[model samples]
Target: MESRSKAHVSWCILLEITVAVLFCSNAQAAPLKITLDTYRNCIDGSILSFSVSCCPGVELDLNVTVVDFIPKRDRLSGHRIRKALQCLTGEELRTYTEKLTRAYELMRALPSSDPRSLHQQELTHCAHGTGSFVQDGLKADSNFTLDIHSSWIFLPWHRMFIYFHERILQKLLDDPTFTLHFWNFDNGLDGRTSSTEGCSEPGHFFPGIYNDNSTSTFEPSRSNRTRVLNVPIDLTFPVMFSEADPAVALRCVNEAVPRNREAMHLAMQKGRVSRDFFGIPFRYGDVRPPMLVGGGSLEYFPHNSLHDWVGGFMRTPLRATGDPVFYPAHANVDRLWDVWMKLGDGRELLQPTDPDWLDAEFLLWDENRVLRRLKVKDVLNIADLGYSYEKVYDASWIFWQNSTGLVSSAMAPTQP
Candidate 1:
């Protein structure tokens, strides 16, 4: 009788554990899938939307080829990994700028109906980012919608977007080796010598390549304050200055470096976890309530703030990508994603394991004007996409010492 009772108790415990596991699995939402029918207008005022479809109607056909991402190692060995350079002054910058401007001039000249055209490229951001889609079975006019921003989707989605955008430029330039460089706006340590040769210097100022009025990279709608020479980009952004007042703006600009360093440190520190860094899960069938604050630390700061700082078209998602400076700006945001994972030796950092996140899919037009489907898991590593960023003085903020002269144990400044 005693043996039988023990057996029954063990069996009951096993059943309970099994049930719990099944329940947890069922609670997770399915992976997101894009369809022509999924498009919608903005459900709230936080992000603007257009009444008309952002995507070109011709590209929405169900019949299209989708090339799955195969590992680069599995492919040909001679393919070069393009290196995206820093925005600082150098011979490299001059060459990159020339190629970039020429490519854009060609891209902009393409008919607006072409998927690779500048207009359509801007619409891609609107379609995916500005509440242009929603969950299945919901009314197009409903108060719930889908946006690539404010969630784990932000990083991977933007990476793929820029990847295709760069590819289009490469096609136009007929140079597969051409790379899309980054605006290193976060590095506020101006005039400091970097430990690595040709790695970086003060890159906080607006990239001059984009400011040249004669180039295709120039956008007149940007803030005039940004054109001021030697005024570093304040990483802390809107919180640091008011453009409305000249005196306060100058004062804030003077104090930008130290404040920027602090902001970068705080953002990285706060984003230690996968959920915190990538943002809350936003899977299929999920209804994003207006109150949901899902943007990760990096996306919220530096990233979004920089968008606002650029002003004009950049301040609005519907028109942000229309500004020529948008691509390089997002390149830095993508670079930081890579940087975030390497922080703390990557022990404490954890990316989402959920299949819903890994398998989330998006549609984009390749350089050939052929529409392709890509998955988040496929772009987890930039190297797989055949690109890498030039090393910069990333340590400036990673080991920053605060006003109190305190440094966290996890990140101690390297001894010179």
Candidate 2:
């Protein structure tokens, strides 16, 4: 009997030791890097199912030096600002809209094969999101697929993607000072716009700049119901309106403002830690399963909700960047990351301090088509990225506390 008990104790110790070794191995994993031969899978297994090659075949200009991303402080015209689209008035609004339209026009005119062209940009998004690319220098039968979504890489990777896109637009315009504008979808409260700090009006509606059919910003494939009926975006999209008819959407629209506030409050309250706010770690050699829900509170909810609401090209990961609204929508997602960092109100919620996360890097083509490598640690500060968002009052949602235990879309309060 004593011998049997001793054997059980030895087995338990061995199991614990094995677990510790596995954890250490994962925690010490290396950062991911991309390569030219990295084949991005083009299979779209979603509702819009299709298969095509998304892999880029362009040969790198090896003669060109690969530059490390250094913030272009000179591009800041007394600090370059990404203003809320709703705030621009008169000449400011007209000029900004015209320039942005012209920039897209120029980008679309580029050859489809050009890495900086609009079509290639769409392909880039597919390569990053659809389990297309894998880690550098891996062998066949390896499962270390490289995707930017559903992990800690989501926020930083998207930020880097847009940064280069803005740069490309600036290059096409020959205007080094041009910056992108963002949609203020989170600020559902009305009177807060009158405040001297952030925006001039409520921005819950889709920005007018993207809706003009004649402009390059317009996308024809999006949902006509929201466009025609003019429904404000439902932040609780996954729960309430993925398949709702227009009547149901309008009914929910009437309650959108309060519900949006509640949704924001809940998303923020849930994001009180690094893993909860940023997402799970995806290190070198990590085999991230496809369609996993590894996104943090903000990424999982509002960021994705807006995408699903936009529908059409914006609906799927494979073709989202084809929609011009995708950029502004993602810009707002990037802005919300900044907002998350400051939500402490003195509590000091922080990002992950792990070296694996801080060291992860990706390759991108700059505005001039120069290849550049960027690291996660380099982009932690927006000011260092040479731009900042207009300050909108988020307090309406920030201070809101959920009283009812309303947890599901079905549980949302409705008025007769």
* Candidate 1 TM-score, true structure as reference: 0.80
Q: In candidate 2, which residue pairs get closer than 3 Å at backbone N, Cα or C atoms, i.e. clash?
A: 40-132, 41-132, 198-391
Q: Candidate 1 regions off by >4 Å? A: 1-28, 36-53, 58-63, 66-91, 137-144, 190-194, 239-253, 270-272, 289-292, 345-349, 403-416
Please estimate how well model 1 matches the true structure, expressed as its whole-model Cα lDDT.
0.69
* Candidate 2 error regions (>4 Å): 1-28, 37-52, 58-65, 72-78, 137-139, 192-194, 239-248, 251-253, 270-272, 345-349, 402-416
- The lDDT of each candidate is 0.69, 0.72
Ten-residue region with minimum lDDT total, candidate 1: 407-416
For residues 1-416, what per-residue lDDT tens digits would candidate 1 score against the true structure?
99999999999999989844432223546987764455322223235223645645444343555555454643223344334344335776677778989998998899886889899888777766655566552454444466788778888999988888887888899987777778887876643454654455767778788889988988899888678876777654552234674532532445777777776776676455676677767777566523235667777677766776677778766788888789988998898888777775562347887889889887777887776667899899877777777777778788787652321211211000
TM-score of each: 0.80, 0.85
